[model samples]
Target chain A: MLDLPTRHLHGPGPSPVPPSVLEALGQPCIGHMDPAFMRVMNEVREMLQQVFGTENEMTLACSGTGSAGAEMLMDNLVEPGDACLIGVNGVFGGRLTDKARRAGGVVTNLHADWGQSFSRTLIKEKVAELKPKIVCFVHAETSTGTLQPFEGLADAVHEHGGLLVMDCVTSLAGRPVELDAWGVDAAYSGTQKCLSCPPGLSPVSLSERAMEKVRSRKTKPNSWYLDLNLVGNYWSGSRAYHHTAPVNMNFALHEALRLVLEEGLEVRYARHRRVHERLKAGLETRGFRYASDPEWTLPMLNLVSIPDRVDDEAAVRKRLLLDHHLEIGGGLGALAGKCWRIGLMGHGATDEAVDRILAGLDAVL
Target chain B: MLDLPTRHLHGPGPSPVPPSVLEALGQPCIGHMDPAFMRVMNEVREMLQQVFGTENEMTLACSGTGSAGAEMLMDNLVEPGDACLIGVNGVFGGRLTDKARRAGGVVTNLHADWGQSFSRTLIKEKVAELKPKIVCFVHAETSTGTLQPFEGLADAVHEHGGLLVMDCVTSLAGRPVELDAWGVDAAYSGTQKCLSCPPGLSPVSLSERAMEKVRSRKTKPNSWYLDLNLVGNYWSGSRAYHHTAPVNMNFALHEALRLVLEEGLEVRYARHRRVHERLKAGLETRGFRYASDPEWTLPMLNLVSIPDRVDDEAAVRKRLLLDHHLEIGGGLGALAGKCWRIGLMGHGATDEAVDRILAGLDAVL
Candidate 1:
């Protein structure tokens, strides 16, 4: 038997899952097609709709991680030779560009500084120039801890007769995501960050408009596992057999979603904001500066530069994990080694968790 | 709170998850990139190799169900315009053809009856004729409870310079699967079937020959999520971050694999065979004939014909679930309502479970 030491998950993801969700995950396995499991799946779909603020019947969980949801949408929507424009602000945005290209879409990249959100004016200009069939961007750029404002972007794309796709991996449950109200066509999210579930399933929602594009595509999506028409049939009332649903992970997501609804989305958002402020203040007192702009900073992931005196970034992070039993993320890609990501996500966004991470950082420094 | 009643889990999947695996699943989720989690991943990879009977370095769990593994292999191996041949004998075999087509493969389907296994001579003849880039078949067809033999098939495919891909979802741990000795280029299995873990992750393995094809592909695999190169980097010694792995599901799979290795594969297979024979004998006394051929039937999933005297199949199944707390599968696709699937897989392949399911069926009849 292997000994697994428990650590406080304050990293970018696999954030501290609640006991209820873990308990649900450990519940006895059931057949995927079992009526009992189907009922649970129904509840999961309903709760996901409430959380995503979408009335779309296409909302469901992709079996893999958040990346799977991104692939699912891109594969279905961006057909061969279809022009797709993406805002490459950070790692996730860059990933979307890669996926779009792989799906055989003619991709056009719109660039923004690593920590900066894309301006609506810039997006509108791109939409006007490229005449893209789909405009993609990250709602919350996990790599840079920047939350891109989605206001007017959807409408701009819609005006151009294009769909707006957003990656909400870091934003979905931690903040307000008005999918219907914002007129967003397609969006995807991970369960770990804001939902406080272990990472596995991706909650994806496609508006009827997006589904229409999928239905009218000239060629089949290159990925069989992610073909929405087939996957949607399984999740929809048809209950057609596709792949076996990851039953236990779905159980965990169901419980996590139940907790989100129980807490109320507003209260949960406020809690994340409150804890993030506390952590930010503490980090600032320790001579830390945020990498992202204050206005665009994500509440769930706090990206802060290491203090000048802290020369060994890896050692500091190692000490936090080894000595204090706490985990925080080092920056990824171009931001690597320059900054640390302190997550205040879902269950980890409590006052006690914030205090512990702050004290651990102080001790390590 | 929703109450999830415990069932006997005699369905095709998810067969009863063991207590140890469930306990491991309930353990606190840590960061996906955490050192401790990485160690567990290493152990899982090693154990998976032992179970798969392969020295293939490219073995890891896809962060989805059995079908995700299927999709991963097809997406990576069958590039656009690549010729792929699939043996469509059962539901899973038909799915292989579908997935291959979706992956942009020029598909050639060889059909067999629902419960019949594919003949090696037919596969060799097809391989000689089509000279496909990839040849796929199911090792165990869960839908019809047929176990296809792999003798000479891999050599025949390899002789024509085509890769052999096997769907070992129901066979891996329940029966002998000599991946290296048999020269199988790629294979994937579900955790819930023979491993007795809850359905979440799919264990996948690829031979060096299969990976060479992936590396030499002209186009990037359409799915960024299922792309093996990126996922392999994360699982391999490089440990490059691809996607946030389902940490707790990996934990469950790790523990489940440990249990399998600890029991010894041969002992486990013998146990399954013993329990299956006991149940088959009991069913025979009730005039319940098997749908699959006697020699080629799967020990893990027994597809038995429903007696004509028992007209209310759904009611009988419902009564078993409600009154006896047993869960057996109804036939899928063409065999729907004509046969019942009684699974004796992994933990459920015990004397006690077999006796209980048989007694319950007797009561229902």
Candidate 2:
């Protein structure tokens, strides 16, 4: 049998999951259409709606990772010849743009510097000019550890009679993701990050407004696997069979969501913020500063500069893995090699975890 | 916490998983970029190639269910305006046709009755007329329990200068699927079926000929999540990050593949046939007849007519589940009220399991 080494997962994702979630995941899988399995799906859908801050009946976890959720929304909502305007500031935002185009949407990108957040005023101007049918933004940029605020962004898009879509892969449970409060139409999140689940399922939700867009699509969804119109029925509605869901993964997500609700969202967010602050203070004293703007930095994913004193960053990370069994993320895209993203998410968002990374960095560098 | 009842999974796809594979799935997750986890992925890829009977270097598991594998092949291979011919016999083949059309291909479907296999001459005629870039077939139709054979089908498509794609979801390990010998260019399978693993991952492989088509595509693949060119680099080449992989799920697949190899493919195939023969003999004695042609009935998935004495088939199935905890599939698509799909696949293909189902039906009826 193949063997795997256990490590403290403190990367951008997947953060460390608790033992109970893993236990639930290991349970024997029931049939997809079985009443017992359908009950599990219903429970997961209900809990995910709570975590995502939406009461939309279409809330459910997709079978693939977080990225599949984004694809589901884009392919189902963006019809051929529809104009899509997306705010691009990181890798995920760029990916959403690609999905929109593949769905045959006429795409226009609203660009921002890496590790920076977009302003609502600028988006309003762009929305007025493009009059796009759909507008997209990344609520939390995993590649840059930047948290975008939806202060007036949704209203701006709504003013133009367009739906608001979001990539909430990094912000769902670790931070505040009030989809209803923000008037967001559609959003998707990762199970590994804040839910403290294994990374296989993507919890996604769409407002009635977003479902309306999908219902009125001019063309069928481009990808059948991620087609919400069909998949949604399997999760709820008439309880049809769209595909064989990753049964065990849903088991894990159900447990993970239960854990989040048990701990409560506000408490989870506070815990993340506290640990991130601890890591921030320790890094600042070690001649490291955040790669993202202070105002836009995310609590769950901390992007910090690699000091010049550390000549070989990869070697340092390798040593940390070998010596401490610790895992931290290297910078991605524009910030690669210049910074490191240290995650304090879900079950990993504790003083012990944050201190371990700091101590490992001290011993290695 | 959400609770799930353990059922004897004998469905068409999610057959039955062993305890050992579930244990591997519950192991602590490591980072995606961690060398240890990468070794697990490498092992899975290697074993998948052996199971697929090919030297395709692009063999890897997608992070979704069985359908995701089909979507990966169709979305990556079928570009806009490309002529494609697909054989439609049951639900899965019709699904492949749906996928090809969504990928912007000018798809021509050669229709076959449910539970019927397509003839090589019929496909050859269609290929000669369309001169398609790709031809598709479902090796095992789960919906109808028909086992499609590649006698001269591959040659017909190849002679017409096209790639042959197959859905081997229900046949990969339980039945013979000689991708290389059959001249198959691409194929995909499910972990839930013959692999005896939980449903969530789809094992897929593409020959160099198929990869060449993907590399030379005019437009980007619709799905960023299933994009082979990008995801392949993450799995092998640079080991760069694509998305957060389902870490523990890879561990489970590695263990599942290990079991397949240890059991030996020939012995496993013989075991499946033996148990299926047992069920067939018992069912024939009990006034139940196979819904498929005797020559083409799948050994792993037995579609049998619901006895006329059982006026309410759903009630019988519910009684079987509630009383014996045995889960069997009701007929789908065109055969909804007419038959039951009795799956004896992978770990579920055993004398004891087969007898248990027969006893349950005998008692319940």
For model 2, residues B1-365, the per-residue Cα lDDT tens digits are 55677688776868888899999999988888898888888889999999999998999998888889899999999998889988888888888988898888898888888999987787788888899998998999999999889856777787877999989999999988888998999999999999999888999999999999899887898788899988888877888788778888889999999999999999999999999999999999888899898999999999998888889999999998888999999999999999999999999999999899999999999
C-alpha local distance difference test of each model: 0.90, 0.89
Number of the predicted model whose lDDT against the real structure is largest:
1
Candidate 2: list runs displaced more than 4 Å.
none
> Fraction of true inter-chain Cα contacts (below 8 Å) kept per model?
0.85, 0.89
Top DockQ model: 2
Q: What is the lDDT of residue B59 in candidate 1?
A: 96
| Candidate 1, residue B190: lDDT | 89
Clash count of each predicted structure:
0, 1
Model 2 TM-score on chain A: 0.98
